[model samples]
Target chain A: MINKTINQKAWFMVLPVLALVAFNAIIPLMTVVNYSVQETFGDNLFFWEGLKWFEEVMRSERFHDALGRQLLFTLLILLIEVPLGVGIALTMPRQGIGVTICLVLMALPLLIPWNVVGAMWNIFALPDIGLLGKMLNGVGFDYNFTQNTFWAWATVVAMDVWHWTSLVVLLCYAGLRSIPDAYYQASKIDGATSWQVFRYIQLPKMKRVLTIALLLRLMDSFMIYTEPFVLTGGGPGNSTTFLSIDLVKVALGQFDLGPAAAMSIIYFLVVLLLCWVLYTLMMRNETN
Target chain B: MSSITLKSLRHSYLQNPQSEEDYALRKIDLTWRDGGAFALLGPSGCGKTTLLNLISGLLKPSEGQILFDDSDVTSLPPDQRNIAQVFQFPVVYDTMTVYDNLAFPLRNRKLPEAELDERVQRVAKMLSMQNQLKHRASGLTAADKQKISLGRGLVRSDVNVMMFDEPLTVIDPHLKWELRSQLMRLHQQVGFTMIYVTHDQTEALTFADEVVVMYEGQIVQIGTPEELFLKPRHTFVGHFIGSPGMNILPCDWNDGGAVFAGHQISLNGNLSNPASTSKLQLGIRPEFIRLASEGIPARIQRVDDVGRYRIIKAEVGGTSLNIYANEEVEIPSDSLHLDFDPDHTHVYCDGWIHEAKGQS
Candidate 1:
């Protein structure tokens, strides 16, 4: 019953953003696509080799190992950081001067640059010096991340948890603060225990923010390169060389542009698929 | 159901209150009989919610004691006090179904499943939500959510007092009447001591047997709805309760009673304390004033025809006053005068009404 006017001029308003996206994303992506489907040896000359690089990247053992490591690393950090961040957020004060102090402290880690975070952890987890490393060593633990595979994985995981758990904490803290005082007052009047209040009230209210925190952490941890690279540089016989590190090694380290381009597309697809699945699964129960 | 007695209950949000001005709730001494429906009526920031919170044990009083049928519950938390409160906005557990939301309080008490189910079912039926028991609480409309909140309170049998802090605020206009009547029927059926807090005079007067009018963190008056309508002890109640409110005219007190402008207005009786050195004013409701052929000289300024009646704005000696008349009453083009019914007119000293001799 309602008539909607169709105006073609609306496209003119979107032209600027469309052009910016083309320049920044679409054009660069086309170049990668061009390399992905062809063979390049030297000079500016390229030969048609359709699907050959894709097949090679898919069958490579190095690519599989890097992907497996990346998956494990992402899973481990998520499992550790989410619960830990929520716990820390729960303990943070809801009011007074303490709230500001706790918020500033939680935000300190997220404000640092990714490379700086990696570099700081690299020196901070060294066996001979650094507060954490020296204390662990003084407590009779052989903790040299530079040479040992187990210690290297431990240091990288710990460093990632330290550098990024604050993001989840800050998000969840905002979610907690958004809940009105009436909910708590009502729960108390309902004779609910502390655990029940957290389960029925706090947890349900924080679902949206927690989903955002998880998705952000999942994608960021999957594509992680700067922190682990600066800290360990995929050292100790490729134990910590994730997909991004392996891709860089192929594209820039060994100059295999075709396979690298193909692998980068696969990496991007994997991240996209994971994020899609996560978003769908988490949002399944929200009907409205 | 139990009687709730708040003995000299005072509250202050400040850690160290220096004076009476720092207190959010001043000295409040009140007692509600068992199974009584009471409404705390006030404007916003008038400490109505503070008083409700103090009684519900959501906030501790700065001083004084609270007794529920003779047992002191001042130190008890809300859970131990066995009091239930519905907030201004509905507070239903989003993840819980209607049945589960009603059963939450009983479950927290570790009641057996059989009794809990029975109680939840009874309350659900009372709220007319029996068919929606399986539906998620969050999916319901605002009115239904508020019903679930009230149902949660009603499910617990041992609740000493059920408090409502403007629970119908978010409800739709048509739904507010339905929910209010439903609450009245529920109160009759359950017989729980209920305290409803609101700034709305209609909600307060129609819902409660006794309405406690609060102003500036103090209980101004507590009386039946009829008593408040007929007689207001304080000028604030006279102004706050009625639509268009009572007209207060600055006057001088003399032996004839109260003198308004140059005319001596006859009051109900003589002021008990005539020697009190306080400023005097005459208080009379608009409905009690009539246009008479021979009375105080007045000029008709404006006439507003409401649905059932007409409000005539008149001026007596440069002071504005409102007079209500029947819609059929003929308006005089000129020589209009006003008459105040002696029985309904009272003299006010300062802000408090000076009770006439032989009148309670």
Candidate 2:
């Protein structure tokens, strides 16, 4: 049996982090819960309206549209990012100074702040001064992202792919590096074609990291707010108004705190539900 | 099964090798018989693995030809070579069931489902892995995982050769012996041309019918285990093939005998045209060094108990020689006399030994 010691000193080491987390997260969470089930007209006059805001949020068509848009965006991200990231990682060098250079370059976009990514892409996609827009216009093509709904949606998706595909690449690259060289040698001797090698060895070996990349990208894209907001400002008549933007418009812009708080809770639950389903599925697959 | 012939094979890692000095493997000429179990035995960095990689087609020799059954396949890739390799570490699909991992290669070829199942079951049963067929490979222990890797390689009988590169290095000690014996049985049942590479003497001696000892980027000797043990062609082979290794003492050749540290020992035969300038040494295995009453005087330094035998490390005329005796024998505390068996002793010049013309 292991000797058990209860010094309580390690708890002191974590006290500062606990205090910061309480201030940043727990207190605001309590306030949201308080506003979720109560009605406040003014001067903190609270009246009980149990389940009323939840019922309103459940029936809201705007909430449904936003949720649909979030799900579609996340699905598209997964469909594109996972395969493209693995492909790029496979083609990368296994060693030498080139590996270090490629790793550093792949990690640059992930290190940039989210809002800065938004602002940078905003300037770069403008129809007149933007490089891509001007180049397309120079070739006699109609490419105004801010005016057309289809173009706006395409621009947002493409921007997201450019911004976050590097994250998947870095993760997959780490996974690829962790595989022993012996596996490749074994595959070579197994008379495996290049496609067979990728399908059987590389892909199966990358399952764990791919799952993590999938979940992270799913959550991040579902909660996406900055890039599309900065690029089109949810213009072209709600074509790109994702759930986060719609939630913000309701809660802070329109000051419907009770219903917004209820919507926020519902949104949190949706994300949590999806995450739990994915986790359980992956864990079950692993166990079997 | 098919024979492999390597002709003037040379390999170099550098694009432009400076002169003939930068080659990792230099001008190797070897031919392996059909269904022969050959071992490339060498210390680390001795180009044994490089030669195996060339045979497996993972590497193309920089200068020469690799032929399988008289067909030139020097330019072929590994997939085109039709070979199976078990690596130093276990390589199995961790997410797949152990049975599925064994069945993967057969299924890849689109073999009939029944035959694939039969082959997987047969190989798993041979490896004693049938009981764990339904377990996910990730949850199994390392030895079981290695068995799965070996089974994956052995499941396909149509492959021309099966190459193993230090496949048992990671297994537990007791399990290593069991795995090596199982490998021998597998070889006997399925006569695939096998080339196993390892640095361990016991693994090489027990598993291979023909052991090719390599040193300094070249094969020094290729013979059976008994031949290598009885007559090692090179000093490195003599030093590498035995347990405590062959005891070597520097000697000066005189008339019909050599003087080793002021003690003149008569040789078995006369040397004709002996090396005039190079340094010479006398080599003998510990088992051949006889401990008796009338020979060169020696003092016992240390005794090591090796279960069934005891190793007597003693000094005779300022030269250290080890003698292997039965564990039940007792050493006298006073002076001791030692004599080497004339037929078993070897005379070395430079690094190669001068073999007697008519010796077996």
> Model 2 in CAPRI terms: which quality?
medium
Clashes of 1: 0
Best-fitting candidate, measured by TM-score?
Answer: 1
For all predictions in the order shown, the interface RMSD in Å is: 0.6, 1.9
Residue pairs in steric clash, candidate 1? none
Determine which window of 10 residues in candidate 1 chain B has minimal summed lDDT: B267-276
Q: How many residue pairs clash per model? A: 0, 0
Task: Report model 1's interface C-alpha RMSD after superposition on the true interface residues.
Answer: 0.6
**Location of the lowest summed lDDT over 10 successive residues in candidate 2 chain B:** B266-275
Best by lDDT: 1
Model 1 bad stretches (over 4 Å): A1-13, B273-276
Residue-by-residue lDDT tens digits, candidate 1, B232-335: 88888998998888898898876656789999887765666555589787889999998888899898889888989988898989999988989789989755
TM-score of each: 0.97, 0.91
| Alpha carbon lDDT of each predicted model | 0.92, 0.86
**DockQ values for all predictions?**
0.89, 0.49
